[model samples]
Target: MATEHGIPKLRIVEPSFDSPLTSVIIDLEKLRDNRLDSKTHPGIFFQIKHIFQLLESLGSARIEGNNTTIAELVEKEISGSRNDDEIIGDDEINEIRNAERAMDFIESRIKNNSKIDQAFILNLHKIVVE
Candidate 1:
């Protein structure tokens, strides 16, 4: 391609349009170099659509919210059982039981509220990305 100074810019070959969006690899540097300030670029538009599609795809792995479960709390209890001896006294056991109750409450909310899973996953995303 011709440049501003009439020099040739390297031609970047386009990938097949037949492939899925998941197969597309975005060039963040090239995108930011030109697109960070440009509003009308299809690159940014498609990327956002791609991201939204990905987030929507998460609904696929979703558990049936119709069931009652505090899987996280249950998992915590199971994990804690692995180191059972670490709890030395009746007081500590009571504390652990209290924690378990709190987890159960959170789990109940997760099971009942339709929006809870999305928020939980979003929080998980923030934690992971941060």
Candidate 2:
């Protein structure tokens, strides 16, 4: 089946334990298990996560040809102003906001052990495009 973007639907493949890449995967898992714990306070960690989400949204917008910089977005956000000129258009700002809304939708809908399916992806696409 084809997706809205005309790409083939994703097929989940199970990895064989005997594959040559198995050892590399096992090593990565071990590294993940041995990772150091964060020393930041929970509140600070949450703030950092929020900042990362904003950065991620900006990066996604940039990938889609939105040239608005992080500083421009942050300044607009802080000032609550929307007087964008030739450099940054309203559509560009809206694209970043839509990406952020998509992230929020994922956070609110998804939980531990939740399965992401085609419906979820389509809903996410709707959020990003709206």
Candidate 3:
């Protein structure tokens, strides 16, 4: 049913196993369960995770019109040089950094058994904005 503002209210419904969508979901779950384990070392795993997080952050920034490229970001990271003559602006860099920080906050706060609630979402939003 629509609200007074004419926006339809969302309703939660139970999943039906006989639906085609349900079969696709089951197939995806099976694929996830059968995926091969990398068995990577903890140190290596962290390194990989950091790389992926950086990529995710950069992608987020790009979506928001931050024109920083992955190569430029990686160069800045590796060189550790924050000179005045840098190709990318500080704002762009900060946008990406903020996204990365938000991702880290999510990782730190969430776990396998954790329930994501409104408070957690608001806190996460604060982190991204601040």
Task: List clashing residue pairs in candidate 3.
Answer: none
**lDDT (10s digit) by residue, model 1, range 16-76:** 7665542545544456468354566788887776445433323322332222233532454
Candidate 2 accuracy as lDDT: 0.81
How many Å off is the CA of 114 in candidate 3?
Answer: 3.4
What is the Cα-based lDDT of residue 47 in candidate 3?
96
My TM-score estimates for the predictions, one after another, are 0.21, 0.68, 0.69
lDDT of each: 0.46, 0.81, 0.78
Per-residue CA lDDT of model 3 for 37-117, tens digit only, reads: 787987999899889999999998898888999888888788876443343447888777777878877887774545677
Instruction: Give the 10-residue window scoring lowest on summed lDDT in candidate 1.
Output: 59-68
- For TM-score, the strongest prediction is 3
| Models ranked on TM-score | 3, 2, 1
Using lDDT, give the best candidate's number. Answer: 2
List candidate 2 segments past 4 Å from native.
1-9, 14-38, 81-89
- Lowest summed lDDT across 10 adjacent residues in model 2 is found at 80-89
Q: Candidate 1 has what TM-score?
A: 0.21
lDDT of 2 by residue, 10-62 (tens): 77766799987888888898897685688899899998898998899999999
For residue 92, give model 3's deviation from the true position in Å: 0.8
